[model samples]
Target: MAKLFYVLGASGAGKDSIMNMVREQLRDPLMVAHRYITRPVSSGNENHIELSEQEFDFRINRGLFAMHWQANGYRYGISNEVCDWLAQGLDVMVNGSRAYLPTAKARFGDQLQVVWIFVTPEILQQRLQCRGRESAQEIAQRLERAIAYDSVRPADAIVIDNSGSLQSSTEQFLTQMENTVQGQKIKVAMDSPC
Candidate 1:
């Protein structure tokens, strides 16, 4: 059995970067689920499969997505193929949406772990600004949304402050993730009939 880790964070919280770093460092078997996004990939970061809105909806209708959500005006989804990796006993990490935790929990039960990465408003603002993806007004709106998310955070989630260096944040995240998985049984429906 493999653990499922859902990484949630604001736009500039470096969620993707932290996951990438951990993936590279871990000697144990692990998999990071690449998201299906309705946006064109850029050199910026975050590995994802691109799709049009029509194509995205088509997949959703066909039950191809295990989980999906719309945020920041984009559609994001976790592909059903992730179950295969998990079935192989590979720990899975994904850039997950906080809004979709309920669905994830319902599907995977105790196998699901939430890792919330966060940054200070000042750092978040700076990082988002550097991405140049949105206007000043849009950035402010995202910052406000982050604050709102904090107030409703899940009681069992492991939170990490990403307001520092990439190395520091990545290390902190990995430590917390290991702690969460220690001695806990995480299954991926490996024994089920397809």
Candidate 2:
């Protein structure tokens, strides 16, 4: 069975860059799901499908999203096409919200694998400053929240410390995915009727 690798991280933890690198190098049966966001498309690094508020509502009404959540003053969703990929035995990765993780776990059950990207406080501060998307005050607030979330992150999550080189982080991310795929194979074999 394929798994849903739901990745969670703080804003400046470099999740997008790491995921992009993984996508380029990954040769496994895995697919990355682009999120549908109500925010307009910007020159930002996040690779997401932008939608108007009305369009977002229309999709919600039509049951087009497999999972949806509101955060940071915007609505984000994963399309139902993810279900199709999983049904076809493809591992799917989604850039996921920390708050919505419980719902995802409840929905995906044993098939959900949580990947938590971690970064040091100093590195996070520098990245946020360089991005110039948030004011210093806002960046401070985000750091506080990141620290609190780090304290309570799920015990079962696979942590990838991305404070160093992107290449190293990419290697770690790929290793975890490979481990998950191998473990899934073992589980399937053990569960098969003799």
Candidate 3:
């Protein structure tokens, strides 16, 4: 069966960056799912549907989204294309908000593997500001929302700390994916004492 690798993180937690790294290292038979969105496409970011609220709701109610969520005033979705890939036994990775995990699990069961990309609030603020997308106030709001969501995590998940160098984080993520894909069980390591 196809493995659904669900990547989760707070806003500005560098989930996109980690996914990009994984993509570069992966070969054929592995792929990333492009999520649909009701927001306008930002240059050089993604392919998405720029629809109005009414149209988004219409399609959503029609059961078009395989999985969907509302975040930062935008509605995002994964389509049947993803389900098709999952049925093909491909390793499909999807980066999404925490709100969609339950629905994904209900649909995919044990085939779903959740990875939480964690970043500190200080790092998140810096990254968000550096991106120059949202205002400082908006970044603060996202941080608040992320904190609330963190408490209710998925039942099965692997936590990837991203507070350090990119190289280390990428390697860690790749190692986890390798183990998961090969059915090699591993335990989470504790942090070193300060």
Best by TM-score: 2
- For candidate 1, lDDT tens digit of each residue in 1-194? 56788888888889988888989987777888899999898735878899999999999999998889999889999898778777776778989887787888788776677889999989999999999988999999999998888886788888888888889888887787777666565433434111
The TM-score, computed over Cα atoms with residue i paired to residue i, of candidate 1 is 0.91
Top-lDDT structure, candidate number: 2
Each candidate: RMSD to true structure?
2.5, 3.2, 7.2
Candidates ranked by lDDT: 2, 1, 3
lDDT of 3 by residue, 1-194 (tens): 45778999987888878888878886656778887777777732554557778877887889877788887788888776777776655668888778877877777776788999988888988988888889878988988977888788765687788999877888898888887777623433222111
lDDT of 3 at 6: 93
**How close is every model to the real structure, measured as TM-score?**
0.91, 0.94, 0.85
Q: How do the residues 32-93 of candidate 2 rate in per-residue lDDT, one tens digit apiece?
A: 99999988779468989999999999999999998999977789999998888877777899
Note the clash tally of each candidate.
0, 0, 0
Query: Between 2 and 3, whose TM-score is larger?
Result: 2
Ranking the candidates on TM-score from highest down gives: 2, 1, 3
